[model samples]
Target: MRLTRRRLCSSAIALYCLFSLYAAYHVFFGRRRQAPATVVRGLRKGAAAARDRHGQAEQPPLEMEEWNPWEGDEKNEQQQRIKNRLQILNKSTKGKTHISVQIWSKAAIGLYLWEHIFEGLLDPTDVTAQWREGKSVVGRTHYSFITGPAVLPGYFTVDVNNVVLVLNGREKAKIFYATQWLLYVQNLVQIKKLEHLAVVLLGNEYCNNEWINPYLKRNGGFVELLFLVYDSPWVNDVDVFQWPLGVATYRNFPVVEVSWSLLHDERPYLCNFLGTVYENSSRQALMDILKQDGHDKLCWVSAREQWQPQETNESLRSYQEALLRSDLTLCPAGMNTECYRIYEACSSGSVPVVEDVMTTGSCGNTSVPRPTPLRLLKAMGAPFIFIQNWEELPAVLEKEKTLILQEKIERRKILLQWYQHFKSELKMKFTNIIESSFLTTNKP
Candidate 1:
């Protein structure tokens, strides 16, 4: 009986010790296993919260072993390097300025004039030498040319102080896309990324204000200046400047070769008109009047039904020769009283007989205090025959036939001098304005 009790006591003690060991194992080893699981769960919850705050979908958290604490630090260092480079570039450009010219390559006149103006303003010596040598002068300025939409985004990287956009408002179909691009560019201006914006607008024949006003108004404060072909009385904005003539003749024809002797020489034609003749236009009216008076025999007139955007090399040469040989060029009003013929005639010392009557269009504001036709040309002191009616042509023709060669030579000299002076004054004013308003070192 004693042996049985001792064995039973030993078995009970052994079972009690095993139970204590099992409890100890659970308290130590089991906690270590659960701790990693708990940590993983907490990390996932934090990642989920971060995603929610950012309005993004929750993504699986990277394993703890894969996490790199220095990743964000490396990204911050890269950004700092970029900022430093930009600051260095800005400092280097002090006392010097850069300008970006955004224009359509097809607007040949605008392209030519802007290039010429910049060349004269920045490097006149080179331009004069090239001209004297009978060589074409490619202008060198701190200016970059951007022609198409594809190049626009690349322009953002150009370190420029000012931007000049040349717009042809006559192209009705392209205005919508142009407006959108302008608006996008305006946003950059709003953020103070771009400094100044300017526009050289080629006014439509109809002088439709609708095509441009929306863009002007949408970014009113952003635009620094505007150069418009037609100056309406209603545009009292201080930023607007009048552009008197298109640069076509100076670009395509050799106006520099014209001399007093050439202009004074006797010619067969009394007047010339070389352009498309629109139905019901003043051109058609002028043609009819010339035909009735039998003046076609004395005038060089070539009329066509459709307007050609581009002139062939032969046609261009013929046009230039006609201007050189003629005493007067007929510039009848089409959509507007102003035409390229008037400017071309001036280049060749051929007097322009402009039809002064305003055509039917949505141009010039009559309500303005000083509403006048061809306000820009009048402002520039252009000497041209301005007649209200085509019926008065016979009287002018008679007067021209009566004038002596000396009188015609004097007139040609006066016209040539005036044209040269006009271009010089324009270059000076444009350079001064740019220096004062855009190229100044002062910044707010």
Candidate 2:
């Protein structure tokens, strides 16, 4: 009986030892084994989530915050670095999404358009200042100006899918060159080498742009868009839009940045007129009117019988100075009612006293349309003194004499503000149009 009781106790001890070993293995080795399984399950769940996201449409880019230039240098630098990093990331994510555009222009007005449309950016052109290449002021468009038909072939390449040709098709000679440029691009398009083409044409002072019909996109031509100057009846704002004849860049008219002095400083002259007087034009009549009552003495009048296409340094300086120092700019009608002087005066914060009567032209003729003359300017609400005849000038100048310094400053501000807004709106419109049209059919 004693031997049997001892055996039972030994058996009980052995069972207790086995249970302890099992618990130790579970606490160490068993937990280690379970950890790997848990990790595998988590990885599998993450992979499933990734696959789900991949199946859905791509998310849009995050909105960028506005940057303040007034911020301190250190903060600005840090912010700029962050912005650059984000831009790089976005570029990587987008994967070559920006559209590259090449602009070609030979005319001086082209430079004017370039200044406004590109927001006053200028890269050095050739020695003649007729050719240039650079990035634009806004949007994804890139511009490369070519000196004209002679340089068009040299600059144009197969890789250049998008193009903007600024041409002066106002006369027979210029129209011929413009036609040659268009035909060359058309042929390229026909062979599927070029994707898109647009034109910023300087239409005739008479609004006679019928020569451009063959190259219009609406007429089954390669040109996708047409930005025509002058108040042409063809302006539809869709494909054919009215482009403002801005300041004369050919004469090196600057993109004037307004200053406190330009606004506050009192102008010495009540009026100014530095231009050619034709044999029998209203300009001569304007001169005659200014001569009466010693108005010419009060005003800065530099009139020449012969018209000069190019301005000498002295003449240009004198002209600019006259504009800067005068409260009013006399803009008598030459061949056309609209002149570069009106815009040039606006740039200098000088009020334009324009001859509003319609000049002889198919566009300005009474039979054509009710608002054929100065339609664009009137539509834009130009704050200028428009007179039917030079007879009204004395009254206008007399009123101008009565205006105080503060009144002139306010008027100047209004003109400058309007001009700035006009340019900005045009820039945005031009950018939007190109992007929308070019992106869908982007070749590169």
Candidate 3:
């Protein structure tokens, strides 16, 4: 009986010890397991309460790993700056103004200005495209482009207050059309039909623009601003701004998209010159020099006796292909040093070996030390090889031979980048100037 009682006491003691260990395990470890869930429930409740108090949903917590990798990238920074500037522009000029781009010239220079500067901001249309009435936030100021007088009726219905008349005053007959357009617009302004007027004039190659003075605001006329082409001495950045003679859009020279091949591809020809070679001109001399050095064989040279105003598709394609396949474009002075070829070469990442001598024109004063021939290009620091005489062409070509593929690629990249920057900077400046002058208050 005593032995049986001893065994029962020992079993009872073991059971008590086991129960204590189980209770301790639950107190220490099991509570830790439940604490996370309890804390999570409490946090969710707190978030809900905060939202209720504020009458808005709680913002999501930022992820620990989320960050912009391109924070230091120059291209990204430029894009951001442009985006910010655009935002400012949009916000400031919301609905205070309405403008129209009236392209009066069929000239490539006119098309170049319209396509590069205003086309992106305005509704895309040609000389024949009909106008529509609507609004969007894509551009700060609303603009409409028309090529002919047929679309004037649409502007009348929309009550467009501001007008940018793009005219080609390059020749005597062209100047007549420009004046007529001015008179028509002046009549509208006199009738209080239009609020503001600006002119984008492709001035004569020689820079004789005295005829348009009577229609300027300074002379008690309506036109407030003038964006003139060529190296006009009158580009004071106030009333008149120097506009670039961009690529020949009339010849269907496209906005060449920068590609790997355009920058790095092995071009066959060392240089190219495909245009009308005038008799006893610098171009004639250039042709002679090229042949004398037997560089004509290495370069793509195509010269015609008469200058054609218009280009055929086949001819234009061939010209563009030459620009693309050649490393350098030989830009001899035509009527002016600044030609469509210079800008076109830039589009193809081809360097322009320009004949930089000032032509006999009223463009600038020889008395003053101002850069006459290509003043705007010089000011903007165009990466072009400028020579006073065609005799320097042989030396330039000889130097070009020493540059390897990698060096050429780097140069092409710089040229393309610079050209794009120039266009964008001009676009922004043009927009800002218009807004400042036309709008009574930028804040809307």
Candidate 2 residue spans exceeding 4 A from truth: 1-97, 125-131, 140-150, 155-158, 364-369, 440-444
lDDT-sorted candidate list, best first: 2, 3, 1
Cα lDDT of all candidates, in order?
A: 0.66, 0.79, 0.78
| Residues 1-444 of candidate 3: C-alpha lDDT, one tens digit per residue | 999999999999999999999998876666544334434565577678888899766753444223333535976889999999999989987755554433344345655665664444334344334432222222346555545334442244435677777788888998886787788888778888787888888888988999998888988888899999988888888898888888877666776788989998999999999999999999999999999979999999999999897878799889999999999999998888889999999989999999878787777645688555877778778898899898998999999999999999999998998888888777778777777787753245
- In model 1, the Cα lDDT at residue 294 comes to 89
Higher-TM-score candidate among 1 and 3? 3
Best prediction by lDDT: 2
Taking every candidate in turn, the Cα RMSD to the unseen true structure, in Å, is 26.6, 14.8, 12.4
lDDT of 2 at 311: 76
lDDT of 1 by residue, 261-372 (tens): 6666876689999989999877788899999878988998889999887767799888887888889998888767777788778878888898887666666767765455
In model 3, the clashing pairs are: none
**Can you write out model 2's per-residue Cα lDDT over 1-444, one digit (the tens) per residue?**
999999999999999999999998776566543334444565565667766889644422222122223546877889999999999989876754566677777666777777654654545644354445555536665655544334565464557778888888878999998888788888888888788998889899888888889778788777888888876778877888888888887788877889998898999999999989998888989998988878899999999899898878888889999999999999998777778999999889999998888777766425464553677777778898889899899998899899999999999999988888777778788878888887865655
